[model samples]
Target chain A: MNLRKLFAGAAVAAVALPVIAVSAPAGELTIPSLVYRTGPYAPNGIPFANGYADYWNLLNERDGGIEGSKINLIECETAYNTQQGVECYESTKGEGAGALVYQPLSTGITYQLIPKASADKIPVFSMGYGRTSAANGKVFEWIFNFPATYWDGATAIVQYIGDREGGMDKLKGKKLALVYHNSAYGKEPIRTLEVMAEKYGYELMLLPVDHPGQEQKATWLQVRRERPDWVMMWGWGVMNQVAIKEAASIRYPMDRFIGVWWSASENDVLPAGAGADGYLAAAVHAPGADFPVHADILKHLYDKNKGAGERDRVGEVLYNRGLAAAMWTSEAIRTAMKMHNTKDPTAAQVRDGFENLKVSEARLKELGLEGFTYGIEISCANHSGPGRAAIQQWDAKAKKWSIVSKFYDRMPEITGPLIEADSSAYAKENNITARSCN
Target chain B: MGGEFLFFIETTISGLMAGVMYALVALGFVLIFKASGIFNFAQGVLALFAGLTLVGLMEKFGLPPWAAIIATVGVMIVLAWLIERLVLQYLVNQDPIILFMSTIGLAYVLEGLGDIMWGSDVKVLEIGIPQGAVDWLLDDYGLYIEKLEIVAAVTGAIMVTGLAVFFNKTRIGRALRAVADDHQAALSVGISLRTIWVIVWSVSGIVALVAGVMWGSKSGVQFSLSLIALKALPVLILGGFTSIPGAIVGGLIIGVGEKWAEIYIGSLVGGAIENWFAYVLALGFLLFRPQGLFGERIIERV
Candidate 1:
C-alpha cells in the first residue's frame, strides 16, 4: 500500500489504456454469405451454401490463400429469415471487409439488400434467382445475377419441354402448370412463363404454395383433376420434398416434373426416398463428388483431416452446388485481382472483374467441371453472363445425378424484345448511355 | 369449387394442427389460472425458452436427444420453483391485473434471455416426430393429417389427462384446489402456501415443456414460439380460468372452428379469414355465453 505498490498500480493502469484503444486487425478479408443451412428450406439451401463455403475454403487452403492474403469468412446463419439475413448483412458490413459481395441465397433477402448494396457500393452477385429486371445492371449497378435469371430458367424449361415434345412447333395444345412457392423467389419465373405461353400456345397453371413449404396436398390435388402435361416447380427446402412426394402420391409422371436449380438437391430427394427418382430439375451448375476438383479436395484437405463436412458427402449434390457457388464467387475475386494486379484491390475492382469477366467452356472442362458447367461471360450492360444451363436428372438407383439435356441456348424469340425494352427502361431510369457490344 | 373445397378442408386440417398447438400452449395458462387464479401470459415465452434449452443441450452440448429432453424438463422444474420464489412470491395478494402485467414483463425477459442464449437461429426440431400426411376415407380430402399434429394432439391429451387426474385425486392436487378456492382456509388447514404455489408453478413448467417440444418440433424451434402463445389468451376466455376440462374443450373448438371458418368463409374473403376467425367466434360466444363455454356465470349483487 506504499511507494512500490503505487508504482505497480500506475503501471497496470497505463498498460490497460493502450490495450483498450487498440483497433481490430485489418489484414483478413471477410466475406459474409447469408445462406440458410438450417430451416424449412435447408434441404435446398444447404448444398449450395456448403459448396459455396467449400470452394472459398479450398481456394484459401489450396490456392495460396486468395492472392496470398488470408480470407476470413464471418458466417451469420439466417435460416432463410429475411430480417436475420438483413441483420447478418448489417453486422458484418463494418469489420474492415475488403469487399462485400453477399450471396443472399433467398430472393426476398436479395430484394431487401438491393438498396443497401448501392449505398455501400457492395456487389450482390445472386448466381441465380433475383429480380429479372435487375439484370439490366444500370439501375442495379452493384447487383449481379450472373449466369442466368429465373426468366432464363423459365425459357429453358419451356424450351426443354418443347424439345421433348418434338420441337417448338409441337408446343401448341400442350398444358404446363407452373407450381411455385408463394414468395418473391417462387414468383420470379411466372411472368416470363406467361409471356412464353402466349407464343407457344401451351396453357399455364400457376399454383402458389404457402411458406415453410410443408403443406401442398391441395396444390397437387388440382394437378390430378386438370392433369397438366408438364409441371415446372419453383420451391425451396421442405416445399421441394413435399412437392415431389405429393406429385408421387397424385401419380403424376415423375419425368414430367421439373424443378428450378434451388428446388433440386440430395436433401429434397433423400427424405422422400426413391419415389421422386427420375424427377428432372434445372441446373445452373454441375453435380457430384466425382468431379476432379472434389477428388483433389478429398485427397488433400479431407484426407489430412481438414474437410468442412462428412467425407461421404464430398461430391454430393448440395455439397457440390455449394462448392460451385463458392468457386464462382472466389473466381470473381481472382478475376478482379488479375485485372487490377493488386492483392488489396477494393470492391470497385471486384465489380470491374464482374463487368469484364469470362469463364469459357474449355476453361471449365480444364478445371474439371469438364462436362458439368456451361461457360459464362459478363459485360457491363448484361450482368447475367454466359446464360447457359443443361437439365440434370436424379437417377435414384444410382443415387447420383446424370445430365439429361444438352446445353439448351436461350431463344431470341423469348429474350430479344424483353432485353431491348429492359435496356431502354434501364437506360432511361439511370440517365446513362447503354453499353454497346463494339 | 371442388378443388377449392378440398383446399378448404386441407386448410382446416392445418388450422386444427395449429389450433392443437395453440391448446398445448394454452394449457400452461389454464394451469396457472386454475391453481393461482393468475393468467401467466409468459407461458408462450417460457415454452420457447424450454425448447431452446432442449435444443442447445442436444445440439451444442452433445447430449443425446433423449437425455437432453429429460434434462430440459428438469431445468424447467427448477426454473418454475425459482420464479415462484424470486418473482411471484412478493406479489401474492396484488391486483390480478398487476400480476398479469408481471407475467407480460416476464415474457419479454424470457424472450431476451432465449435470444442471448440461443442466438435466434430457427432450428429444425428433430424429436423423431413424424411429418408425413395421413389419409382416411378413400384418401381424397376430409381428414388427411400430418403425423406431427397427431403426436401433438395425443401429447396435449395426455398432459390434460395427467393434470386432471392429479388435481382431482392426488393429495397435493387437493391442496392446490384448496389454495385456489380459499388461500386463508387452506393456510388454516395446515397446507404451506409457499409450497403449494411452488408445486403449481412447477407443474405448469412441465406443461410448458410438453407444449414447447411439440410446437418447436413442428415449426422449427425459434423465438417465434412466443407469438404462438398469444393465441392462448382468447382460449382462456372460452374455457374459463377455473376449468381444466374447459381449457381442453375450448382449445379444440377454437382449433377446429377456426379451420372450418377459414375454409368455408375464407374463400369468399380472399383466404385470410383464419386470422380473424378466432376473434369473431369469441365475439359470438361472448354475446351468447358471456361467462364462456364452461366458465362460472356471474350475477350482479350491488
Candidate 2:
C-alpha cells in the first residue's frame, strides 16, 4: 500500500479507539445520556455531563439502583451537533430492557428527538430548553420541558427589567436588545419577547450571533449604536462568554445586561473576571455544593474517588442543573415503578409518571434540595411545572453566583395563548389530535 | 459630529481593529503557504494548543505568567520541529493536496492532544494585558474602543513589520524564498529545504501563539478559539494565500464591509448577515481578482 493509504488507515484506527459501544446487562434500567463532552461547548457541557453521571452513579452506589433496579447510564457523546445527537439516540435507545428516558441537554437535539421519541414511546426530559410549545403536553405528549421553558425565561426577564424600572408601566418606550445565538435554541424566546414588547411598549432590537460565536465585533458595535436601556441574551456555549466580554469591552453596564439560564455559568462569567460582576441571569436552582444531595454525592461518589468530574465542581450552576434533571427523571422513574407495581417499568409507564409527576416542597426537603429549587407539579396538560425562575448575580471577585431575587412565576396570561396557538399549529400540521386532559 | 457620522466612524474603527485580529491568525497561514505552497489548516489549532499550553502551564505547574508564556513559545518550537520530522519529512516530495490533508489530520491530533493534556475546560488566560474599553476614547470623543483591540492592532503591526524585515533582509529568508520558487532547484543550489521548512513552521507557530494570546484573552481560551480559522479563510481568499500584507488589507476590507453590511443592510433583512457577508465579499473578490490584489500573476506559457 502507498504511504497515503497507510497514514489514512492509522488515522481511522486512532479515531475508532475511544468509541466503546454501551450495552447494558439485562434487568437494568437504562437511561440514555446524550452528552457533548468534546466540542466547542465542552466547557459548559462537561460539568453538566459530570453532574448527570455522578447523580446516576450516586443512585447506583447509595440507593442500590433506585429501589432495586441497577441504573445503567449510557453516555453517548454528541459533540453538540444535531445529527450526532440523533445518531446517539438511535444507537442507544435499545441498550438494555430498552432505554427508559433521554435528557438530550441540547435544544437542537431536543427539537429533532421530540417526534422521534414520541413515535418510539420514549420520553424526553429537555429540562429548561427545547420548543417552548412542547410544554403543552396535550400535543407534545412524550416530550417534557418542565421547571421552565425559553418563553417563560423571556417573560421573567422582562418582568425583572420592569420591576427594576419601578413598574410594568415604566417600560414603555424603553429599548431592550435581545442578543441571541442564531439557531432554533436562541430564537426560542423571540415570539414571547415580541408579544411582551407589544404589550408593554418596549422597543425590541434583535441581534443574532451565529454558532460557536467567537467573533462578535459587528454585533456589539450595533449594540453600541442602538444603546438599549437593557440587554438580554439567549446565548449558549462560547457565545455567552464572547457576548459577555464584548458587552464589557463596550462599557455596557453589566448590571443591566442579563442572560438566560443556559448563558449563566462559572464558565461564562469567570473569563471576564471583575468585569462580569453584577451581570445577571435567570436561575431555577441555587448554586454551590451546600445542598445535602451534594454531600451524599460526595460520600457515595467523590469521597470514594469515583466522581465524574473534579471533586470541587459538585454544585456548580450547570452541574446542579444536570443533577436536578437527573433527580427529577429518577423521581419520575420511581413514580413509574410504584404506579406500575414493578421495578422494571416500561418507557410508556415512565411517560405516565412524568405526566402525573408532582414534587412538592416537602419532597424537595426530603431529597436534600429544599431551597435549591421551587416545587414542581406536572399534569397531562402541563408538562412545564411552575415555569418560575429567579435572577442571580455574579460576584467575580468571589467567583460565585448568588440568587438575588425571589422566583417569579411565568405569566400564564402571556405564554398560555402563545403555547396553545403554537402547539395547535403543530398538531394541525402533523395531523394529530390534541389529547383532552379534563 | 452628527450621531450617524459618529456611529459610522465607530463602526469603521472597530471593524479595522477586528480585521487586525483576523489578520493575526491569517499571517500564520500566509507564512507556511509562502514557503511551502501548502495551506496549513492546523494554524488555528496551533493557536489553540499554544494558548491551552500557556494557560495549562500557569494553572497546572504554578508557573508565573511570563515563565509560562516563554515555556509555551518553547513548546511551540519543539512542536514545529516534531511536525517537520514526523509528518512533513515523510511527505516531502508528495502532492500538495497530500500535504494539506496531513495538516488537517495534524489539526485534529493537536486539538485532541490539547484537550487531553489540559482538560477541555474554559481557562481564563490573564497575562495582565489591559482589557475593557479605552476610557479616554469613550469619555473625550464619546467613541467606544476596546483596549485589548488596540493592543491587538499594535501587536499585528509589530508582527507584520518584523516578518517583512525577516523575510526580505536575511540569508535564511532568501533561502526560504528560493525554496518557495523551486524546491528541487533550491536543494540543488545548497539551500537546505528541510531547514527552511522547519524555520517557516516555527515562525508560523509563534504567530499562532500571539494570535492565541490576543483572541484567548477576549474569549477565554477554549476549543472554539480554533474555529477562528474560519474567519481567516476569507482573508486568505481575498488577500492572496501567499502574501502577509495581503492578509491584513483583505482582513480590513472584509471586516469593514461585513460590519457595515450587517449594521446597515442586516437590519432590513432581520439581521445576522455578518457571518455570511464576509464569505460573499470574498467570493466577489475571487470573481474579480483571482490572483488577489498583492498576489503575483502567473505567466504560464502554453
Candidate 3:
C-alpha cells in the first residue's frame, strides 16, 4: 500500500503491457482469415476456410514461409454474418505490422468492408464474388475481384447457352429463368443478365428464393408452369442443393440448367444423389487435387498431420477455390516483398503489388499449378484480370466435375459499359475521385 | 380442362403436399405443448439432430439405412430422456415462459452438440424413398407431383392417425393430458408428471425423426434443416399450438395460400414473397381467432 511500491508496480506494468501486446515480431506477415466455420453456411464455409488456412501453412512448411519470413494468420470466425465480419476486420487489421490484405469470402462482408478497407489502405480481394463493379479499379482502387466477377459469370453462362443453341442468333425468343437467392450476392447479376437478354433477344424471368431457401416447391412449380428453355441459378449454401433437387424432380434437363460458380460444388450436387448428373456450372479453375500444388500441400501439411481439414476433402471444388484464393494472395505478397525489397511489406505496398500482379502460364507451371487454372494479370487500370471461366459438368455417377469446354473470354462489349456506368455512379455517390491508372 | 385451371389444381395439390411437410414438424411442437404447455423451440433442432445422427451412423459404422434409422431412434429417445431429466426436471413448476426460454437454450446446446458429435457437413440421406416426379400423374393428367411428396403425405396421414389414437385411447396419454391440464393435481392423484414428460418428449422425438428423414431426403441434411422450424412457426400460430389436427389444417391453409399468392400475385411485386406470405396470413388469423380454429378456449376466473 506504500506510494513508493505502487509507483514501482505501475512502471513495471506499463513496460510489460507494450511488450506483451506488441503485434507480431518483425519479418512476420499478418493475414486475417474472416471465416464462417459454424452456422447454416458452414457446410460451404468449412471446406473453404480449411483450404485457405492449409495453403498458407503449406508455404510456411515447404519453403519455411514466403521468403523465409513466416506467416502470422489471424483466424477470426465470422459465421458468415456481415456484422461479425466487420468486427473481425477491425479486431485483426492492426495485428502483425498491419494486415497486408483481406479476403472476405462473403459478398455482404465484402461490400461492408470495401470503403472501410479502402480508407484504411488495406486491400480487399473478394475473389470471384462481391461488388462486380469493383472490377473498375479506377473507382475501387483497393478492391480486387480477379479471375471473374458475377457479371462475367452471367455473360459466360449466356455465351455457353448461345453456343449450345448453335449461335447467338438462336437465343432470340428463348426464355431464360434465373432462380437466385434473394440477397445482394444473388441480385448482382440481374442487371447484367437483363442487358444480355435484351442483346440476345431472350426473355429473362427472375425467380428470387428467400434466405435459407428450404421450401422451394412453389418456386419450382412456377418453373414447371413457365417451362423456361433454360434455368440459371445464383445460389449458395442450402439453396443450391434444394434448387438442384427441385430442378431434378421436375425432370428439367439437368444439362440445360446451369448454375453460377458459387452454385457448382460437390456439396451442392451430391445431395441430390443421381439426379444431379449432367448438371453444368461455370468454373474459374479446374476441379480435382491432381495438380502439383495439391501434392506439395499433402506432403508438407497433411503428411505431417498439420492439415486444416479432412484429407479427403482437400480436392473438392470449394476447397480448390479457397486454395486458389490463398495462392493468389500469397503471390501478391511475394510481389510486394520483391517490389519493396523487404520481407515484411506494409498494407500499402501489398496493394501496389496487387495492382501490378502478373501470374503467367509459365509462372503457374513453376508454382506447380499448371492447368489448374488459367493465367491472371492485374494492372492499376484493370483489377478484374481476364474474367475468364470454363464450363464444368458434374458426373453424378463418378462423383466428380470435369472441364467440358474452354474458358470463355469476357464479353467486354457487354460488361465494359455496365461496369463504367455502375462504377461511375458509385464514384459520384461516394464523392470518390477515379484514380488515373496511367 | 384449360391449362390455367389445370395449373391451379396442380399448385393446390403441391401446396397441400408442402403443408404436409410443415405439419410434420408442427406435430412435434404440438405434442410437447399438449403434454407440458411448453412450446419446444428445440423441435426443429431435434429433427436436425436425428438426421445428423442417422447419417453419422451410416457413414461412421457402415450401417444400412434401416439400421441407421433404428439406431438414430434410440439416440433420440435417449436424448429426450436426458432433456427431461437434466433440463425439464429442474423447471417442473416454473412459468411456461421460463420453460420456453430453457428450450431455446436447449436448442443451442443440442445444435452445438450435434456439430461436435457428427461434423457439420451436408449429408445425403437416401433411405430408399422414391424421388422425382410421379410419372403417372405427369403422363395421365399432365400434372407434375413428386413421388417423395406423395410418400410424405401418406406418412403424415398415418402418423396423425397413430398420434390421435395414442393421445385419446392410451392410459399414458390420459396421464399426459391430466398433467397438461393441472400438473399439481395430476401429481396429487399419483400421476408421475416426470414420467409423462419423458414419454411425451420421446414420442415427439420419434415424430421429429420422421420429419428429419423426409426433409433430409428432399434437400440433404444440413444446418438449414433447423431453420425449417421457421416455416413451422406460422403453422403453429395458425394451427393452435395445442391441437395436432389444427397443425395439419393450418399448414394446408398457409401452404396453399402462400403458393397461390406467390404464383398469382407475387409476379406483379417482383416475387419471393412466399417467405412472408404465410406469416401475413397467420397474422390475419391471429386478429380474427386468437384461439385458432381447433384450439380450445379456456375460461379463467379473474
Candidate 4:
C-alpha cells in the first residue's frame, strides 16, 4: 500500500534533475564500474550501482557533467568474480581516461586492481572492506578506503558493546560471538576481534556461516548451547535475515545481536518483521524515507519517470548509502575539476583533485549531510578521510530503527601502531617497497 | 551443583532444537536419494527458493498467511513436476555422477533465478510460527523450549510417519519401491516410469518445501539455504541414502552431537567443533557398518 502511494506521489510533482554532461571535446573522464547486478550478491550491488549511475546521470543532466565536462561511465558486469573484475578493469581502463578512480566494491578486486591502478595512475577507493593497513596513505597512495575501515568498525562495535555492558571493565570475561559470512568481507573483522579479546579478556567465539547464510542450524545451536553473551554479524544479503531468525528461534536476546552496517536493512528486517525486534546494526547514514534528498528524488527524478526505483523509497538505508557514495564521488570530481584549470582534466589531474580534498563541516551543513557524517577530509596520510561511526538499534515499538549512541571515539593510539605493522607486512607480502612518508 | 547442573541441562534441551533443524535438511536429502538415485545438490537451494517465495508473496503481494502457504506448496508441487518433465526426463539413464553434476548446475541456475525474481536482499519471514516457550522439567531447574523448535520437531515427526505409511501401503508407493529395486523390472511390470519419476521428484520437492519453511522460519530465507543442504551430505551418509528413518535419526544425531561437541570440546580445541562433527561421526560409523544403520546390507555370494 505504501509502495503504491510512493509510486503515485513520484508520478505527480517530479521534474527530472538536470544532468551534468562531460564536454568530452577531446578526451573523456571515464569512470569504470565493475558491478554485479544479477548474481547471488546482487541484492547489495544493484542498489549501490543504481544509485551510482543515477548520480552520474544527474551530474550529466544538471551541470553538463563535472567541471562542465561530461562524465562517461562504463559499467562492465563482473558478477562479483575477481577474474571478471580484472577483465572489466583491463577492458575499461584505457579509453581517453582522466583521473582514473575505481571503486571495485569487492575487496578481492580491490586487492587485484590496486597494483594495476597505481601503475596506471588510477586511484582505488575501497570505502569499507579492503586492506585495513591501506589506512596509511604513505604506503598506499593510490588506494582510498574512506570514512570507516572494517578494523575501525570492529573497534567501534567493541566499544559500543563494552559501553552497553556498563563499561570497558564490564567486557571482562564476556562472550562475544562472531556470526560471519565465510568470505573476505567477514574475515576482515576477525583480526581486530582477536586483538580485542586479548585486551578485554572477553571470550571470542568465531562462527563461519557459508555464503548466503540461510541455513545455520549448527552455528545457531552453538549459540544456544554456548550462549555467547553477544553476536556480532558480518554478513550481507540473505545471510543477515537468517542469523537474526536463527537467533530468535533459539530465543537468544535480540538486543545482543549487533549487525555490521551492510547486514542491516529493511530488506533484512522486513522479512522477520516483528520477530526481529530489538536487534542492532551499526549505521553510518540516517535511515528514513523523510530526508530532503529522498523527497527531492521522488519529486524530481522518480516522479519524472527518471529515478532508479519507486520515488517513495528514496532515503532507504541502501538508497541513502548509494546516494552517499555517488554524492561523495561526484563532489570529489567537482573539487578535482575546480582545481584543474576549471575545465576538462586528465585522470592524473583527478589524483591532484583527490590529494588535498576537503569537505568541511560547514559544507556538510549546507548539503544536509551534517549528522550523517562528521566531516570528510582526505589527505596523503589518511585514506579514511572521516573517522567516525554511530550505533543504531531496532525498536519494535516504533517499527523503525533508531540511533542510540552518538559517534564513539576510536582509539587512534592502538590503531596507529597496528596500521604501521600492517603496512609493513603488506609491503613485505606483496613484495613492494614501503613508500616512506618523507 | 544445582544451578550449574540446571544450566547444563537447559543447554542440552536447547541443543536438541538445533538437532531438529539439521534433521530437516537431512530429510530433504534422504527423500531424493531414496526414490531417485541422485543426491540432489539443489536441496538447500530448493529450500532457499521455497522460503523466498513464501516471504516474497506475503511482503510483496500482500498474500494472507494461509494463502501464501497454500500457494507456496502448490508452487513446489509444480516445481517438482517441472523438474521431472524438463531436466530429469532428459537425463534419464545418465551416469548418477553426471546426474549429480546437472543438479549442481541446477543449483547455480536456481540461485541466479531466485535473485532475479526476488531482488537481492535478505527478507524477514514473520509467518508467526510460535515464539514463547513450552514449560518442561529439570527438577530444580525448568527446561524451556522455543515454540518454533517444537513445531519443527512435531512437523518432522508427522512428515516422517506419513512417508513411512505412504511407502508401505500406497500403490504409487509400491511402484516407487519397484522402480528403486530395478528400473527395467518395474517398467516391464507396466508401471509407468515417467509417472514414477514425476512422483519421486514431486515428493522430493514437497520435502524441500517443508525443509524450506522450517529452516527459513528459523534462519530467515536467503540464498544461504543452499549451504544448509551441503551439510546434509554427512547426514545422508550416516542415515544411508535409501532409508527415511536414517535421515531422521541421522539428522537428530548430527544436530545435537555438533552442538554438544562445540560446547564441551570447543574450549579444549580453540572452540570450533561444528565444522567437522558430521564427517567425523560418518567416518566412525562407516568403519563399523559401511551400509549405514537403516540401509540394507549387501552380501555377495560368489
Better of 3 and 4 by TM-score: 3
Clashing pairs in 3: none
Computed on C-alpha atoms, the DockQ of candidate 2 is 0.82
Model 4, span A116-158: residue lDDT tens: 8888988787776678778888878788887778778888889
Ranking by lDDT: 3, 2, 4, 1
Query: Could you tell me which residue pairs clash in candidate 2?
Result: none
Put the candidates in DockQ order, highest first: 2, 3, 4, 1
Q: Individual DockQ of the candidates?
A: 0.14, 0.82, 0.79, 0.33
| Top model number, lDDT | 3
Quality of candidate 1's docking, in CAPRI categories? incorrect
lDDT of 2 at A141: 91
Docking class of 2: high
Residue B73 in candidate 2 has what lDDT? 88
Minimum summed lDDT over a 10-residue window in model 2 chain A is located at A18-27
Interface RMSD of each: 6.2, 0.9, 0.7, 3.8
DockQ of model 4, rounded to 2 decimals: 0.33
Q: What overall lDDT, based on C-alpha atoms, would model 3 receive against the true structure?
A: 0.93
lDDT of 1 by residue, A1-438 (tens): 699999999999998776444322444566787876554454455556666766677777777567776676767788788899999898777656444478887788888887787679888887776767667765567788878888788888888999999998798998998887777788887777878989878898777665654444446655765689999999876567668877765567889999988877776665455667899998877777767888778776888887766678777767776676676777777788889897755777777777777878787776667766777777777787756667889887877787799867766567756766865775587565655542
lDDT of each: 0.74, 0.92, 0.93, 0.75
B22-57, model 3: which lDDT tens digit per residue? 999999999999889998999999999999999999
Docking class of 3: medium
